[model samples]
Target: MKRILPLLLTLVMAQPLGAHPHVFIDTGLTLAFGPEGRLQRVKVIWIYDAFYSLLITQDMDLDQDGDGLLNPDEKAQLTGFDMQWVEGFNGDLVITQEGQELALSGPQDVTATFVEGQIVTTHWRDVTQDTAGSGTYEVTPYDASYYTAYEVTLPVEILGADQCRSRIAMPDITADLDALRQELFALDRQAQPEDAGLPNIGAKFADKVVVTCASS
Candidate 1:
């Protein structure tokens, strides 16, 4: 299936555009634990900004009546439109334990809807690693190239694990942006940041949700 957003092509190319994030997403996360207290899955919720939502609606020919709401048929057509990810795509989510990134299965239980002129979507990702005994984990959502910005604006919930709790660690936007600007200025006029071996600065600006378990 074709992806719903064509701008994703630019994101995958990772061009050195040197521009701010064009697409904004308000992200929500729910951590699900298994009977043994291991991290089982993550339920992700994405609410796109109004402008981008409008673009998506236009691209899909949805909301033909311009009523700012999707009917049943439109909702069905919009479902899973963003789930058809390209190869090497990380789904913009990262889960790490002790600095080692854990593996996650592809998106499942995908659903989508149109609400108040915004696009809202949800999906599930199974944590394929055994994290039962791990006391702490980091979950981050970001676009490496900074093409899209993800803000953990919604509440973070822990499910099936009373001992586990989550806290959001927000980055220092001013400091991060200052550093990015210096790096960009250091680059030769003809050289792109990627060509200059600059690291993924987007990670520096990401909000990290730290999940800790008192008893595992």
Candidate 2:
């Protein structure tokens, strides 16, 4: 696993400058269910934006020919580069059912590829316990400091779960930003907006995947 840079970790935990997203990713989710209709695992896909991809490739000296595609050797070198999760990192994914958060194992079966000048990665996470039969499960991806923005642009797939259906719930950015600003103002009346310590407002701007299962 690659260890996250210390400066990056600090920025992610406490963004004193303000809560704004610097990197963007198009996220995809695939929920897997066992034969008994219980939730088993989740597959997470991340396609990074072109600017970030360019930075990564340039930093790593990949695609030297400037063709915008990585060869087999370069692809192999890029695999699992983001898997080096620091301690207590959650991979920016949150899964909860009935208002209780679920435990998920660390990333596994990781793969990475560069396509169309973007870095695309996929990994699977096993649910530590059974969680599907009835009720709704909410899967949200977010960075607490709002440094990375994730949008559910790809298709949400339900695999081996005929009794379950999934839908995307888009958040209202304008309203959420307004609420956050008010809260920040309440926190500090004299300090400037940039100087006030920003709260963990990433979830407010996240797109949620709501999974509903028919009761057995």
Candidate 3:
């Protein structure tokens, strides 16, 4: 006789995870600049939601002792698991300078730890080149698919410079959502279901840190 998969397996294979948020994260960013006022790197800190943390802790199977705490081995395993993004993810962090998108290298100094029943990861990424030119710069962190919601939890910081001030601006997504609803309402019933859904406008809901420098 041939082995058979279970009914739940068949259902899950037919309908994979949808484009809805399943995880949430609290993010903090620190902008680092050289002594010459050239932007150098960005440090990111992500704290997983308590419920997600519980899931991660259980999934990793690191707590061999069943002590309700992450052992050293488990900590080591989580140090860079999430930071290691695939070819195109970029960890959902986007930065633009003077209306041009800046290319950032991979993350370095990746680390993870369990704190207050939450998993926290920290890493830093360097820009491909010095972006010291006088212009407006913005940094936004968001997951394009909205599979995870990222919220800014720390005040924006400008390191190694006193002339530049950073302010966090949260984009309003109400208009975008309302527009999408209206579009769906007006869609023809004969149209395919996939053709009448809202667009992936996750970026519209991201919070940005705008950095302004003193005029020369």
Which is the leading candidate under TM-score? 1
Q: What digit string (tens of lDDT, one per residue) describes model 2 on residues 1-216?
A: 124455544444353433345578999999988888877899999999887677677777899999978889999989988888978989899999877888899999999999988999999999886655568889998876556789999989998878789999998758768888566535432333345556556777789999998887
In candidate 3, the residue pairs with backbone N, CA or C atoms under 3 Å apart (3 or more residues apart, or in different chains) clash, namely none
- Report the C-alpha lDDT of model 1 over 1-216, residue by residue, as the tens digit: 224455644443354543445578999999988888888899999999887787778878999999888889999999988898988788999998767788999999999989999999999999998565458889999877555789999989999889877899998768767777677655544454466565675687789999988765
Q: Arrange candidates by lDDT, highest first: which order?
A: 1, 2, 3
What C-alpha lDDT does candidate 3 achieve relative to the native structure? 0.71
Q: Candidate 3, residues 137-190: lDDT per residue as tens digits?
A: 888888764446788986567797677788889876587666754554455433
Off by over 4 Å in 2: 1-19, 174-176, 179-197
Q: Indicate the residue-level lDDT of 48 in model 1.
A: 92
Candidate 3 local lDDT, residue 156: 69
How far in Å is the alpha carbon of 113 misplaced in model 1?
0.7
Error of 1 at 137 (Å): 0.7
After the best TM-score superposition of candidate 3, give how far the Cα of residue 82 lies from its true spot, in angstroms.
0.2
Candidate 2 accuracy as TM-score:
0.84
